[model samples]
Target: MIIKTPTSHTFVTGSSEGYTPLNAFDGALLAAGIGNTNLVKMSSIVPPGTREVPITELVLPPGALVPVAYAAMESDIPGSMICAAVAAAWPTDPAKPGLIMEYHAHGHREDAESVVRRMAEEGMRKRGWEVKTLKSMAIDHRVEKIGAAFAAVVLWDL
Candidate 1:
């Protein structure tokens, strides 16, 4: 297999409802503008020198394999809430790779968001790196029948 290091990254979050759990997940992906692409779930690591991009400036072709660190939650219980979130902490040292953290739970967006952000900070702390910049995104859904929430830090190249 070939390995490619991404050049840039972006954050995305989306919530959706559907008839089934998988459908709800798909809808959430679609709502996040990342549907139709293969999401290759990757571990939390932002390569050194990589920069952040606006979600609108990033695009993926259908059927392409995309690398991401993500959190996802799905629930079928009506009126239940689900939240997903992700955070990226860039190290103050440009030579060091940054860290990414993901979290999902049956809770409000604020709860999930806070957890993921702290996770990022803890990861950087473990590495003895100080965060130069921190970025995050989160989404929550209220289930009617089936619902899903998804958040991700997409790593990509031009």
Candidate 2:
């Protein structure tokens, strides 16, 4: 499910007509066994409604050994379950050459956002994804924000 973090709403209302690298990432993780075996898909829940938007709706196998982030409104951090949720929430768009998954994270204590960012960067590096270019993506964390939160994005070329 798409957890609308307190940080930004851009990812919430963004266009639905784009590729979904998030789906690719999910597939990769599952294949690598970084997630559970009974993971459910959530791409259909992007414009997450009230009750259906819950993280459990996008269930992945629990007890993952990986570092799972905490659940917070301001950030959709990359816990193993959240990653599964992201993979589930991911949708495929033909507009781009690849798929994309975008979300945010909260780091109230220590550098939570920074940690997630580093993990993503390192994970990508381990996967051998060279930085082709840096594009300015958009996110809308509502006003009156506190603590540390950051937008996270992933893309993959099919």
Candidate 3:
């Protein structure tokens, strides 16, 4: 089987409360505008020369398999906070692949985003690459009953 490398990436985030954990997850995905597609979890790597796209501009067909690096969390405790975040750090060298990081915890969206951004930077540093740009998205949900938070870096081909 031949795998085609993605040529672009986009960030998305959403949070919701529902009757069950799975329902909450589904609601969050719908809020994120990615409910219909199948999320195929992928390792954290952004190919060299990949472009950034706005979530509104990046379209996917219903039931399409989408590659994503993401973070998600679910909580059933009333009034408790749950957060998820994803970050991408592009290298200074155009030929070098970028790094992506995901983080999730019981916290604020800002905290989750901070951790993932730092994670991306550290990942790039570990690869001996200097970061030129960094982008991230995060979501936080307070559980009325069951709640979920989700964030993702979606990869797509041209």
Candidate 4:
């Protein structure tokens, strides 16, 4: 069997409040523009030569199977904050593969984004790869009476 790799990827973030935890999560996914697709969670590897595109550029079938690296956080406590972030670090050499990092916390978007950015940088450093570009997205949700969800993802078509 031959294995195929993704040709491109995009970063997206979303947050929402809902009547239930699951509903909140679903809302977050919809806000991220991926709720209609089936998600396949993958590890942190950005294939070499993969192009980065805007999320709006993606055109997939309603039930397409999407591959992603993601982070999510949920809270039901009123006034509580939740955050999710994802970062991708590419090497200076375009032919080299890159790294992706996901982070979630009970705090603000900046904090979560910072953590994941550092994580991605460290991942590249550990691999002795020179960093060229770092891209990240983060979402923060303030919970109300019911629940709230925050999510960030590096999404790609298979």
TM-scores, all candidates, are: 0.96, 0.24, 0.96, 0.92
lDDT of 1 by residue, 1-105 (tens): 317899999899888898899999999999998988899999999899987888889978898899988999999899999999999999899989989999999
What CA root-mean-square deviation does each model show from the true structure?
1.0, 16.0, 1.1, 2.0
The stretch of ten residues in a row with the least summed lDDT in candidate 1 is 1-10
The lDDT values for all models are 0.91, 0.27, 0.91, 0.82
Better of 1 and 4 by lDDT: 1
Greater TM-score among 3 and 4 belongs to: 3
Q: Can you give the lDDT of residue 68 in candidate 3? A: 89
lDDT of 3 by residue, 79-137 (tens): 99999999999889999898999999999999988899999989988999889999988
| Model 2 C-alpha lDDT per residue in residues 32-140, reported as the tens digit of each score | 3333433222221122121222222333346422222222223222221211111112113322121223334322322433343444444445545543322223222
Q: Rank the candidates by TM-score, best first.
A: 1, 3, 4, 2
Residue 112 lDDT (model 2): 37
Which prediction has more favorable TM-score, 1 or 2? Answer: 1
Q: On a 0 to 100 scale, what is the lDDT of residue 127 in model 2? A: 44
- Residue 49 of model 1 has an lDDT of 90
Tens digits of lDDT, candidate 4, 65-92: 7788889887888998888989999999
Model 4 per-residue lDDT at 51:
85
**Model 3 bad stretches (over 4 Å):** none
